[model samples]
Target: MLRSIATFLCLRCQPVTALPLNLRSRATHSVAENQQTVEALYDLSVDIQKVRKLKGWVLLQSPAYTKEVAELLKNMGASGPIIAHILTSHPEAVLCNPEQIYTQKELWISVCPNQRELVGIIEKFPASFFTSSSHHDNQRNNISYFQSLNLNKRVITKLMASAPQSFSRPVEHNELMVHTLQQAYQELGGEEANMKIWLQKLLSQNPFVLLKPPEVLKENFLFLRDKGFSTPQLLHLLSRLKGFVTELNPDSMRRTLLYSQDTIGCSETELRDIILRCPALLYYPESTLAERFEGLLSAGISMCQITETPTVLELTTQIVNYRIQRLKARGYDIRTGSLEVLNGTKKDFEMSFGKLQLRRERPLFNPVAPLKADD
Candidate 1:
């Protein structure tokens, strides 16, 4: 099919006296300004034909760039869907010189241990190859910086894959960012091992941290400390919560803290425990918390019970109520073992009690959902 289309395009491409005004810009120059070989080949008519033939990511350059990229891939022995994906996602990669592309491929292959693995990484992130070439010095310094923070190569590569934009910064800027993160680590009683631990937690919890402003991270780190999170507790919650990807506002953080302290009546130690055990509680809206609590109460769960098993608040009320009631109807005593019932998985609960077998109440319950309290 592609051959037929290319043939049709070649037949259609007659040297024209004038290109359309809208298509003229594309005919002028490519993203690769220094490469002069394709300068005379900037026949917009021919590129339009190749792009149409490709039927995927449209190449903005003339036929020369597309042909050269295909030739480069052929030389690398890359075939199959990988080639199509690389072109569609980062068509601009063709802008890199053949030598640059070859250099990047070799660099990745050196680390990847196999040809297929190298091609897989490039397929997902073709720009990875381009970034490695012109920025080897900066890349080395960045790797050392991550190592200084105790990130292993695997972890560093994971972080880079998630947020490649981090490599776009120069050595000086990345160094400043590293210093800011290290300072935050230091402020939190940074023992040798703890520095590595804290930095890795921060990175894994939020790969986007490498892309975030250092000041934002600094502010959030201090805010948690001001809220009385111990060093370890802060590290746990900081990564688990949205703060890793976003700047957590003081007001919002304070609101979660106050709710846990006032409404939940969590003691300082208990608050810390709750934050670490269930850091996601901070992101829940008050309405959701209230609704979950209300469901527990409506189903005869005491305030004391809810407080003791705060994690239960995370589960939907329907599930809790259904599981408890189902267990009760099956000759089990829920009042005596409510804690385990609420904490355990829904699958186990269903497995133990069988399929919520209430013929009369079937219509009222979701086929796959837990039964209503009354049902």
Candidate 2:
């Protein structure tokens, strides 16, 4: 009996897929030859070993399958204590004789410690005592149903102690600590040394200090404009000084200095001194007429002509044409009827010119000019 048990135990250790069909056939033959009870017990032992190995949970569709698996465990000499643990961990494994415990597709999810407990349980039960029944639901409930569980202050204290470090500190204090750490690392002196780490940690810890680009720009514009600076100069100053200003200063001294110059009329000497001291206040030249002309060309205005001499009629016509072209390019709805009016005006001017010429051609009463040689 000892050798038979040892062999069965050894067989249990064998990979389930590697189990010889012949051995299975023999086991099946033994049960069938004996009775349904024996066969059920034999099959149960095999399944329990499989479950113990953590291969997967089995779904018992019928009472016979459950009883057979239980009986097999019993035959293997599985103990009550071990069985209790296994049943606790895998309550779903227990099934009524008419019900199945696992399905072919369902995963047999069991943790490692639970699996060990299950295996130990199977080796202590008696083969004959194992039976299929409808008590599986009760067994399933028993797994997580630990009686007399308590939640004491000590347990709560232990849980709090194990929590994340950030949870222990005031949020603002945490931010200060991060900022201090960053400033420390930055001061430590290597250009490539973990600067990003310290900086990011600092920023993330206190994100309130970060300013949006528009706000920064607006502040900058206000700053420079307040300092008696022109728009072009302010833009130039902003471009040059952007790299140095790392932190946003809501109460910036520089901003105050700027506001004083703009709002409070500073003495000429003070203003000059301020401009001289601030190198970023330097200005660029204004756009020239030539530049404006080039801009017009760049904007797709064609058929333009400019000359040193200017005539009222020519200038007026040029202005009108320029306005019309600009309006058309900008998607304005110009009517041909208006253009006809312009043509009619031009024709009238032509006719007026012809009449004036005809009047001049008409002989005056005493036309004065260089006397003819005959006179």
Candidate 3:
């Protein structure tokens, strides 16, 4: 007698979409028919090679449909890991009607006209196409949902660009997330304008902001609050650098803060003030953050000058070196800040030294009328 098929099978080997009882009964027969059926299963699917090693495991359905799916993917130019990922994640995709895949492709192509751009979108969001047409349309409709909020098309594009996964979420779910964010702001005594500005920050600095639970956002806000940001400075940090505050580990932020204080020999209040003025410093690498500050200190630059133009810290090493060397070699010290030396264009730099662009224009044709009048 034939050994039980269950003896060699895994739990996941169960039929997800089994054929009818009568079909299974009719297909069963002597050892010859069973052997042929098992061979056919292995022969049909390329990803099903492990069956060769199995004692009695077999594919429940004919691989004809799966082969068709693979061919359809190849015809549509799907490559390598993307194809394997789709098949592995959603085996039902093999049973999907070709028209469904075609329609989905057309939908994305309409929005992303350039072939290369579509490829990039697909690479970033490869799982986007591995679902039923209805599900695909639901995710595609997310952009429309953003539009319904009175957001411009450009904002929608930017949202998708920043986080393509955002498109995969349901519209109502994201709207609810946004609503929670707005309610949180209102509860905190923020104005209507505050909500609008916050929404802009969410769209740019963290497109996935809407995906996070409301509590997480609240926690991050509170953490930033503990760090001594006023309401305005908090808004600015959220607007300019969401990832630094939310995505970065709190311990790392604390270490960076501590390192900066120890290196610069500044008080906590002074560091807070500097960060409030230029939040970018909070996100910069701890290792190199001191170079600009230390170099400026050696050049006799003061804290007041840095406080006035904090962007000086962001200047390139080349610009800082040139400015410092130029100053030292020429026997002059930086009186204020190195704003012009670090940032100005060549023409602007020359103009800062009192040099100006000369101008010329054609002379008027006044002499011809005067000559006629004299004659």
Candidate 4:
């Protein structure tokens, strides 16, 4: 019985021995396969390097993987020459993260090492790669970004600070303080020309006259009055509103002059005289003001003042109606009953008028029809 038990134990141990041999064999085979794969990968990498060197291809290695470079390479057929040139030209391309070079709408070439070389590469590349207007636009944008990065902010600030202020402030005068007195001296009953002269005399002592000649302050006053601005309201609008309109609009200047005219009840001729008396208002026109005003108006600023008074409202309605009637006189359907007029904004009315005039002025294009063989 003891011999039988020993034999059974030996059989169990035999199975355990076979299990170890099978595991050892499997492990050895796996190691060999892995070694072979690694060797094959090494050989392929070597061949790739040889191709790069022979073709003068630069090796572009990013510190981290870059989808932009990968995509660029893929798109260019992963050409060895192009890759080598890009790598050699931009050695530091790999220093930045992929995100630094990639934008949603554009694929920018790296400009880390040498900008001139990068430009050259771009120029030499197949026209198909960057022939589209959008691609050229991307290149221009990238170049601008690079230039901005290189710009010295401190230098720019210093230059701006050194520049002189373009416009001088209004001069103060004791005589100009009496609005009633100024109104009594004006001719033409509140014309812009007369009021300008009065302001000049009143502000003669002031070194800088904010109100200029030929630009009546009373006309500006009247314009503002029509728009419903009180004396304090006009002041508030001039000082508090921060925008292109306030800074650059001649209409704003004109309105201010009108306001002064109405405030003093001076004539246009008097205003011109006032401007001459106060020479500061005669400063040269700033080129930027016109552009700035256009931008402000484009941003949907209805700066032309409107008054809530019944009489003024009636006048404004009449003016608008008259303008429409004038357009209709020229055969334009500008009446409120017309579909275009009903659907259009004030801006649209002007645009339509311009378009209509352009159409009439444009030469006709008439192509000869192809002749039929039977005919």
**Could you say which candidate leads in lDDT?**
1
lDDT of 3 by residue, 55-171 (tens): 223333333255566666656676655555555444545555777767766656645545555545554554454445666655678866776666645456556655656676677
The regions of model 3 sitting more than 4 angstroms off are 1-102, 105-138, 170-173, 187-190, 210-214, 242-244, 291-304, 315-336, 340-375
TM-score of 1: 0.59
State each model's CA lDDT, in order.
0.60, 0.36, 0.58, 0.36
Give the top-scoring candidate (TM-score).
1
What overall lDDT, based on C-alpha atoms, would model 2 receive against the true structure? 0.36
lDDT of 1 at 101: 65
Candidate 4 lDDT for residue 205: 29
Model 3 pairs whose backbones collide: none
Model 4, residue 133: distance off in Å is 25
Residue-level lDDT of model 4, residues 1-375, one tens digit each, is 999778645533331112252332212112112333223223223232332234211122213232344344446355545544543343233233444444311433332233343344443432212222333443444334323434233221221122111011111221243243344233224445545444333333231222233234445445545644445544333222211111233465565456545533567666444433332222224233233333323433222321111111112233455555656666765322332431245576678678777776776754565556884
RMSD values, in order shown: 11.8, 30.6, 12.6, 29.9
Residue 169 of model 4, lDDT score: 15
Rank by lDDT (best first) = 1, 3, 2, 4
Count backbone overlaps in model 2.
26
Question: In candidate 1, where is summed lDDT lowest over 10 consecutive residues?
Answer: 37-46
Q: Can you write out model 2's per-residue Cα lDDT over 302-330, one digit (the tens) per residue? A: 31121111111122335445544644544
